[model samples]
Target: MKPPCYLIVLAFLPSFSFCEIVVKGDGILQDTSLTKNEATPTKPQASKPDPAGDDLILFDNGDVMHGTFGGIQGGLLWERKDIDRPIKFSIPAIRQVVFKGSSGVVMEKETSFITLVSGDRIPGKIVSLDDKSLVVKSSVVGDLKIPREHIKSLSPNPFDGELFYSGPYNSNGWMILDYRKTKEKDKAKEIAGEEKKPKKEVIQENGKVKEESSAWIHSGASFYSLDNRALVYPDANMPDIGRLKFKAKWKGRLNLTLALHSDFTRVLPAEKKEEPKAEEAEEIEDGEKPKAEGEQKPRKKEQPEKQDPAPLQKERLVDFRKNNAFQNIAWINPSKRTHADMFGTGYTMTLYSSYPNLSRNYFSETGVARTQRMASVRSNISLSEGGDAEIEIRYNRKESLMILFINGTYAAQWNDLGGFPGDGTGFGIVNNTSNARVRISEVMITSWNGMTDSANSMIHPDRDLVLLGNGTDRFSGQVIEIKDGVALLKSAYMNAEIPVKDLSKIVLKKSTSTDLDSDDLSEDLTWAKEPMTIIYKPFGKIRLNPISAERNLLSGNSPFFGEITVDLSSAAMLRFTEGSPDLSDWFDDL
Candidate 1:
């Protein structure tokens, strides 16, 4: 009305050149020139090339780099071969650092392992126990005084049985077999005629020929499988009565099949036997010659064929599923064999994600031939995706029982009337889902004493709890006092004194005077507004705020436990949570 429309547009044209509107991936338009000094946008620098090094650094975005770790002060300092100077990375942006060829402290004798309420397990000798605190002498930290309220369980003789295997310390003797390649090879054979065997790629190194396939990435104390592959520990000296325990963390569904007492090292095709010709069959029958139409033949007792003495074998007294009481949800016939079937004459425990979770155990008499579901249980605990679990399987052949414990709680047990199967002393794990990624650590196999672990009792918020040695033994009352290895309980029925050695676990009543919430009481320590988590070797994890790392010693202040120092060698990994200003923001400043 006052000026023409063209005149108004011309007035704002000069101001438009000062600010450039940029649309980001989030669909937000940003005035770049107004916020930044330059009009030209800076491109992100390319990631540095990985160098040949032992230590590995994992970032939050799943990028990994090989470098030498210098140490940590305010942040971590890493040295890369391609770079002349050491690079400093913010702690919040790093996932973990894995040191190759690093073995933690080894305990020579028997030790007591204590599981804390926060889920950190400490291996040490119990120094003293009382109503106030429990003192333990650790090989790594010397001694630690833990509060009674923080302890979840105490195992006096954790390593009571003979240890057949305890490591995964490195990727020296493990075998990773990729099933996808096998499927592809079979498909190629079907199209190119079965008479021609598919050629396989082989590599020659150190005067030896080896076949190449998918391999599990060994990072410090863990083994990671990106694709669905089977990992086998061949020729393991497994005992008849033994225990298998390991910790597994995964992304997406954790579909895993564990094989115990397996006989085969690798999956083999079924051997086909040709039928005898009619003429040959008639000649064999004629040789028999209708043994004496009327004459009685002298019976001769033939001596058993002499053969090399076999290893100690146990007789199968009872048949599994003798009565067939439990309903069979699925049946695997002898004719059908999948690539996932990697073992012969053993037991397979499958873990599924579908609810009633459908955790099942199946036995195969001859590989996939005549496989039957022995027992199945609908797990009450939900193993959600992207979570972790501590799984334990105890097999007692003498007792004809196999028990499963998840996260220290008794889950289910299977009885085998047919007795243990297979003479092979090996174990294997197969990932059933191709899209899922799995990480396994802390693999331990040891002899069992034919006794199942007691199931932990539910903690009552109002009353003190005590669980005894037996699975079902439990008591709820106000704990009067604990002195001289005996606990005094005052209940409405009676005031009883029980020996602590006979008790499996004890949960004390919570105090009401604290202003902090119960959940806040267990919060991990924080530094620079970022939480820190430390993983220990064998099995253990704790959270604390690191002050400094020098001379291979990490000093930190814990929220639950006060100031403490731990050897860096004992630590398997360290993780940090993101802060307000992350590494991406720091990069923008440059």
Candidate 2:
């Protein structure tokens, strides 16, 4: 059979002539024309001022363009101010797009979210439900009748409370600072003491000096860090009981530090005090009596007592050092190390990836405190090399407990024996890898009830699972119907009507053929002429084969959802390509 007409037309496109697209294991798309070198420096050059436009597109090689979205047809059409004709980009050449002024959909009071078996999540109010199909009233895309077999779990109150933040829409208020540079400055100050001249002045007095640049680059909705750097959201007003969710993609080993309840706007070095010499200490202790004899005590005239600069006063320095809050350092793969600290108390967790993958956790409360081994088990939560994972952290300061979930699996939980430290509401992240590239996006913080999912619970292979609010109560049953915020479940012992608010999660019986894994979905997309993953706003993802587009609507065919049309405005991101690098090769090369 001959190729499609659009493919024939795409062959003649001018943009394809000079641009060579390369897709990385982390799903980053790079245009060789925009990048002169494939290797990134240990400390990258300072990023230019963000371009000005209503919409922005980020290329994989850290290049960005300010333009207007021209919608998607056979490929993405981006209209630029410098060009009269719209430039079409293949899916593999674009990282992400940020639509200016696009806010998250405001969910109604009665709204709930459903997670499909294909990993798609949709927010809507349940109209009615049965074993065959679920009718839902979506505020954005109108009513949707989702097949019952595709349903995985349901959340009655996904947010639990109002949404606090759902962005990384732009880098407007974000502070990206080079971690190494700040530490170096702090070290230099500590060694040189307060009497040393300022670095800028010293440079002027000596010779021209080079200034360090930030290791992170912000393009559109994502932040890419070349070396160690800290991305801080100083304005975050974290709820006492809240959940933080973000998607991170990185190349090479994943080493990251997540700080919660942090008040640190910028890194502040710890205060250092010099010890007095033996004679100086004795003379000071002796006061004016002993100093009279032959010492003289430099008594020409008593000038005003010298004082350190205002910013370096003892009280001010102490206040600055106190801003360092709870932080978790997580390193995956070869390192297989994790550490969490709050104030002076914390724990270190080590992991082994192989069979009997024994993990250990050791807690320390103080220097003289007894060491405690809280818990240890063989965990299956292993992060592959050069792979991406979704990291979710939920903290309940009221309960002094924090839970971590990796790729939807319960990894571990920690209870702060010293109680949750710091009342500050800021959140921050540090890229701990030296030369690897890290990309962070889709960051969202929302008020939570501080409940953990039942991913660790045991479930019968043939029965549907229902978990209660307490995080431990659960049962296996057949879900007959769901209505009026109550789930009707028929179990072996009795039929119960469980209130939705009392439930934490519901996992339906898996269908062998209907439930498609992500790997399976990616394999099917390989055959499509133009395959794209449309990440809808609020929540949800759908893989579609683009047929055509008109105005703001994109009509496409999903192998799983069949014929469908998506409003371009309702989408948060559009991914053109998928797949991770081979794990064996990555490990061997490392």
Candidate 3:
């Protein structure tokens, strides 16, 4: 059988974004972002595990707690444990819960169109709006909280990557700085040529000609990629990245910073050499003019010696540590000035700006305390008057770098002195205009774990334990020490070691938790050791290494229970205590 012509055509169209290239029966498309090809089918498939990344709970103050996610039990957390004294949270105290991976998620975006008093529009999802503050979420930048007074009104908006704040933006969650916006070029030309028309067509409104033909000028701004050709479509509709941070040292070692690279090539005129004076001297040795010979051999103007063009300036690559480092940064607004920023080791700081086109200068705090003085930055970067732009402000404890790119070109990079930034460093936006207000779609302060190359692995199981002598006997706790293969278990009441030979079933805990178990657990306390679930019941379902169950009595090792030979004849079950690398590497592998 022959494939349909359109399917054959689709095979060659490089413009399409099909995940698979196989031909279809009638050319009908298939949605296979998830699952597998249907050609090989089985009776049925088993239920899948949660597809998100690590189950992380972030605190409002910037601290993070990792756990296996024991669901809320009796208004208390259960399943896994890794928390400090009085392990408790009201659920509302959490800033957000970042799931394990992006699988099973729709990846759809719901945005809020914030209309500032200046009539500017920005898009994001409204997380909260109260008298004190307004918190918005972006698939790009995670969550952003702003002061209430800084906003005027908010309305829902459809998520379109290139629609408003998407073009040329990225998943890093663009902070649309609507400093200025300009109209389309054709509209500008139409208005320029409008004056040439008949006087009768030049009707004036509000002291200006109302040229409907030139209306396309204010159709809102658009953006292009670094090449300035393909329209940029920042995939900003992610569920929640939590943060976009990397280590001060990991700038060039990871995907986020490595992807920010841009190169520049410049050509300079060759140096001119002074021509010898002897030619002119020979032309007029004596002041007297000689009689012209018949058609005096036309002395071709002595061709000046050809000077070698100065070797083309070597193409330059952006250095995150040097001056004008942001020369390759991209921008969406139009400005004529540029700024510079610096970054080194230890501390980190950055500046964000959304300035009007006429505002020739902006200021930076770098990493220093404000002395009521704003360090002005003169910029050579420009975008449309009403469009927005963002800057990359990376700071260390001793230095900070601020880079701004505009209209697919490097604009400015500002460096200053201050402490390096840690997690949860907050930032804000201030409107310098009264009637021309702007909306800051996001105020991103990046933070993540892979910012360094230290040898230590930052991940461990949230909780680890073992089940011995038939599933009925269980012990949950940390493995403090191992001696000659005999593992030591540290539980609340006792710390004992169990031999490897006695092992029946061992469920590996995947997260590290700090919450202390209750000193008084019911004899029936039990939990299933799944990826993100807990089980606590059904004595018949319990299975484990065979136990010499002389009647109901069973033997297990314990510290507090003392007697080298412990018996579980009186209890129902047992429990244990719970919970980085490549990367870019998943934590579950360990």
Candidate order by lDDT, decreasing, is: 1, 2, 3
Candidate lDDT values, in order = 0.57, 0.57, 0.29
Cand. 3 Cα-lDDT: 0.29
> What TM-score goes with each of the models?
0.61, 0.65, 0.21
Off by over 4 Å in 3: 1-53, 68-70, 74-88, 103-304, 311-355, 358-590
* Residue-by-residue lDDT tens digits, candidate 1, 391-434: 88888766667778888877767777777765667777777777
State how far residue 509 of model 3 sits from its true place (Å).
Answer: 54
Top-TM-score candidate index: 2
Which candidate tops lDDT?
1
The regions of model 1 sitting more than 4 angstroms off are 1-53, 79-87, 159-169, 179-220, 223-225, 235-238, 247-254, 265-341, 355-368, 375-390, 406-411, 436-455, 458-528, 577-590
For candidate 3, write residues 397-507 as lDDT tens digits.
223433433332344444444322222122212222222323222222332111221111212254445545332455777555434535567778898877633543233
Worst 10 residues of 2 by lDDT: 327-336
Q: Which of the predicted structures, 1 or 3, would earn the higher TM-score when compared with the native? A: 1
